[model samples]
Target: MTEPVAYSTVWHVVSIAIVFLLGLFFCVLIGRKIGIGFRFSVFLYLYHSFWCLVYFWYAGMHGSDAFAYYNQGLLGIDRIWFGSHAIVIVVSFLTSVFSLSYLGVFLFFNFLGAVGYLFFYSSLRCASIGSKKWVNYLIFSVLLLPSVSFWSSALGKDAISFLAVNLALWSALDFSRRMSLMYLAILLMLVVRPHMAGLLVMSLSVALFFDSRAGTLRKVFLGAVFTLGAVFLVPFALDYAGVKGGANIDSVMDFIDKRQSITKGESSVDISSMSFPVKLLSYAFRPMIFEATSVFGLAASFDNLILMFLFIYGICLGFWRKLNPEYGNIIFIVFYLFGAWAVLALTTTNLGIALRQKWMFSPFLIYLCLSYINQRQLGRLK
Candidate 1:
């Protein structure tokens, strides 16, 4: 009698192959749409997959949130359309319908992250057009950073949020024609994090209000729409973020205090005592190499070092002085970046959380800095 192969082993092997093939197909398709070379897209997909596997191994060793999400999905929770529950629903569908193993789920999320990388890379390519060699190098360095790929590759909110942010960013490059994409991106963000969606809408509204390139009638129409959106979204977002008392100064301060007090650990800091600038710095650029206590911290520190250098370089080059008010997209991104960063910095008291969450805004800062450098290079040539 022939020996029977284990069904679990067969399922695992088939799921892995399908996920890998599907990821490559999507990568190639998105690359073609974005006008990137196939080889580069494949390289990026492979690189991101490498980090996905790394995350899988790490999760197995550490018993991470990925396992929690997977286990919850196995319970067959009733599906919800938005919030963190949506991620569990996705896991449920994948496991119940597709019979994907845990490794398969990680690969699937890794593919989503790779798609996001395509959008991110396309946005930077648009912004860096005509930039000098060094600017391109810096942009590549940012893309190659492991922290982003690693955190976003597992079954969690981070992968979906990263995709939403990048999709929004790419749509902002040509906002009028890509308004549908922007709407989709905002919807996706709302599903994961309503507060981020609220911030994105607020930023777009402010940018449109000041956009010289937009017609007055268009501005008026959008202004009303955005006002309605804000009225609905802001309160919901505040409630979700644990600011139940509303947007008053006292409420916000209370929320911040609560956040600081609750998030205690080895990586926690006394953020309540820090000045506003220091708080921002700590959230965005702390855990420098000297302060790093673990291998992961050391890696993050190196990435931060690069980011710090870019910030200083942009300032030294007077990047802010070169901003043009007509580019409403730039204005939109700047407002989004600052607003998100400020809120997160105020609420995040743990370096580990900051490390994982800063990707939500740090990429915007990086794009802005690189765009400014590219513009400087173009000016010198002219």
Candidate 2:
């Protein structure tokens, strides 16, 4: 008899990476041409935000991650000795304002999701895609997909990560000042989702390596790799050290860990015994799409996985062209996206869903790469 679908389909994740690459390449090209301004950039992103709002509503209809947003913020404030970023603070306050009702919080979360995308689009404008006219409208398709909308502004980890991504992408494209908004955003990510944060940090650093002005010693292309390793180790180190921490993190970790095991064909372990800290990390860094969304009874798609890999390869090919031919942001986007996805793919199969949380700013990333690619065909006079 043949093996199960999961075993036979292990190769699907590779495909996901490739699709992400192709999408990114086109994004970079578009970003460079549109450039940053009040006109084209704002209109496009606003359109995206509008669709994203509709998507959030769709998720509500099906009852998706809405509960997650409502519940996570409560977990945040209910715990002590844990410091949240500016957005988290707002979420915590809203949770209290809503008196812990899931429905009320869901509405608030979707509102923030729309606002988060606004910042994300503005950040992309700061980067500048280059080409324009009708092509700009074409990019809004990112938000037009039923699935994309269903999840776009809905509550949960996706919204949290999108806020961080918005700030990061904006900074990646903006002023050269060390204190840029992106630096703060990256710093916040350190505490939030360290692994993916590190992933993007490393990826962008690689992109910066191609920037000519970035310099080897000062910027550290290897930071993201090291950061990812550290993210895994940091919790255990802290827990072992007897440092004061949250009440829920440990309990949550225990429940999730016990429930989440490498064991195949067996039912999940007890959620109560699993460690809360581990669960927090799992929700934040766990790579298997099926495992993470298993709570929703959502199934995996072999085809989506294939698309991701194709996307990565397309971006990588752009890099092959840029690193040698033009040495622009195209190479940076290619390097960062490939590294982020490649590293995550190695870590686990869950990356398909988890990556979505962080890649909300992917629209911006696509533009960043495309902008640089477009820049290649034009240069200074001899």
Candidate that scores best on TM-score: 1
Worst 10 residues of 1 by lDDT: 1-10
Tens digits of per-residue lDDT, candidate 1, 80-171, equal 65667878888889889998887887788889888888888888898787778887888899899888788887788899889888888888
Query: Could you report the Cα RMSD, in angstroms, for every candidate shown?
Result: 3.9, 13.7
Candidate 1 collision pairs: none
Query: 218, model 2: CA deviation in Å?
Result: 6.3
Model 2 C-alpha RMSD to native: 13.7
